[model samples]
Target: MIDHGLQHPVMVELLKKALVDEALASAPTDRSSTDTRIALQTGLHRKDVRRLREEPVPEGVAAPMVPMAANVVARWISEPRFLKADKTPLPLARTPRLGHPGEPDFPTLVAEVSRDVGARAVLDELLRMGVVSVSAEGMVLLKDTAFVPQEGLGDSFHFLAENVGDHLAAAAFNLSPDRQGPPLLEQSAFSSELSADQAQELQRAARRLWADVLQQFLMSATVAEQRSSSDSGPKQRVRFGVYFHQAISTPSLPAEAAQPARRHKKKPTS
Candidate 1:
């Protein structure tokens, strides 16, 4: 977290407020005032608790940030009318125009996903992020397989919150002792003694498997959405992801060896 630029003071305050909020939520109906309970549980001064409680909540607190540009890209890539024979997004005309019976141009896609936002504006944003590129013939081509924002820090942070936050929430729900239903799918495998070469091979294998599975899932979801009877019905969105990690550990190190290495003074050179 320090390497990520979240310094100690900022993290400390964030943690304190998070703990206080969780305590207040756990016992909402208790006779004690929320500020009092939060202060007691978090060991923060009552005055500080009051001040923190009154501060305006940060944007994108309760929900994940889904940028309009991302939505446009997802729909463009996933929707059947926007795809070609091989299931890849078709190169669209840079300017708006009527296409073949079912095929849609760039403007049509932008209109479908977000009518208020201009197609040119969305295209510019995508081009800036390297998600789309223009050809010499003035066609906008989808260059990215996913609608991940690659250029903006704010967008990156939002993606981090949406992806990692949901993963953690699922794990926490499964771990709760009082969980009523079957746990959401969460599983992992770990090994302590894999060589670097073996780890790289496993990483490549996992990437291939995940990519295949994700494509199938996206296609199924797109078909389902198209075939749904009620367009206005209540809807729920879900995100599933795959990750890989490999790290070295000094499990066999002696107690002294486990300690931080110290720099020793060099002997005087002759």
Candidate 2:
């Protein structure tokens, strides 16, 4: 859950226009890139959207963005959550250290939060991707970031990205969870076309696409639990990292013609 703060109305509107119904929704066929659509929705020049969307995935994308966002955005966009299971009340379970922006290792914290949510594996995939960063001190921290403004961020790109990352971190960890996909990128194993640099590029590209999905979602909440909390106070500042776990590639089996058989022992004749 996120705290939307006094800018709730603005954030919601941004969600509607820039995210869900972005610019490319109406763009002519020549340019339907999601990046272009984000530009249309956010009122950002296409150049601005390009900058945010095209920025490479940061050094430690896979580590723990949600943990950092949850802590950083709490004053602006979250509620402190104690780890708990479905049949148990969170307050009755374990509570994380709160009111501190220095974040916990979300994957570990989430493992402590809810195993059914698969937050740890989801976080592992993110670390494999190289988008979010974690410090040696075990703090879940946001890396330096660039932002793409849609309708309302104005000069507040990082603030929005941080919240966006926070929201996705929750979606992947705290809220309704899914397999979050290949948390890291892999080369075209089936194809030998990828050079080392090209494979790296693919990884970076995937991370951006994932982050874009997050940006639109955070701005779209209307009556979200966390947003309601933030709206009652002065907006808090936060940083975020959008993560995507790359799909684990499955190895192909050899052709039947190429298959090898084990030698069988001959039966003795009576």
Candidate 3:
């Protein structure tokens, strides 16, 4: 927020708005809560609550939490049909072959995720993001193991917000007073004493582990999506992710150096 130039007042307003929305959602739907009740819950002024309530909701501007290009890339690297025998993503033709109706290709990949969006458009986006490379013969290759976009600030920020927000949400749900079922899986490994080189090695190891985990999870999720297509019921989204961070810590004083000076026995000497 500081980088974005948002000030304390802006943060307060955002927090108040979020709290009010949460309170409203949790309240009984049969009866609408009064402005007083909302203000009490959100700690905003009654007038502010009324004004916020009356304000028109900005419409049709929301972006997807997960970009379609990302889904395409994930499918490319995870789905068996799109992967080589060695588990790496297979290079794909720009379009399906003339007679190969069921063959996996770039167009088919995008179409499976969303029919409304055209494959050409998605391909252009992936190209712009540097997620994929195209050959002179109209073949697409997955340059990155994941959709960590090298270009496009908007997509980068979108992933940052989506991943971090979901992570925090899981932690919050675990701490909620009325949480049900087992707590969402939220655990981390930490070790403070490590050389910088060791930290770098650990990060590389984490990346390798994440690659395997991502492939396994995506495969399961793809199967689940296919199985649930015919059923008419509520659906839930899940995000399982890993992050690694390392920083140098200030060195602490040794026990001998940290101890106070001992007083001399001057009186006994005299």
> Native-vs-model 3 lDDT?
0.83
Candidates' C-alpha lDDT: 0.78, 0.44, 0.83
Each prediction's TM-score against the native? 0.77, 0.24, 0.85
**Of 1 and 2, the candidate ranking higher by TM-score:** 1
Residues 28-134, model 2: lDDT tens digits: 67456666566656767666567655555455322344444333222211213422232111221112342234443354445543455554454343343343344
Local distance difference test, candidate 1: 0.78
TM for candidate 3 is 0.85
TM-score comparison, 1 vs 3, better candidate: 3
Query: How well is each residue in 160-246 modelled by candidate 1, as lDDT tens digits?
Result: 888888899899999999898999987887777889999889988987777557667777877787677478878777788877888
Of candidates 3 and 2, the better by lDDT: 3
Q: Which residue segments of model 1 deviate by more than 4 Å?
A: 24-33, 61-66, 97-102, 190-198, 223-235, 248-270
Q: lDDT at 166 for candidate 1?
A: 89
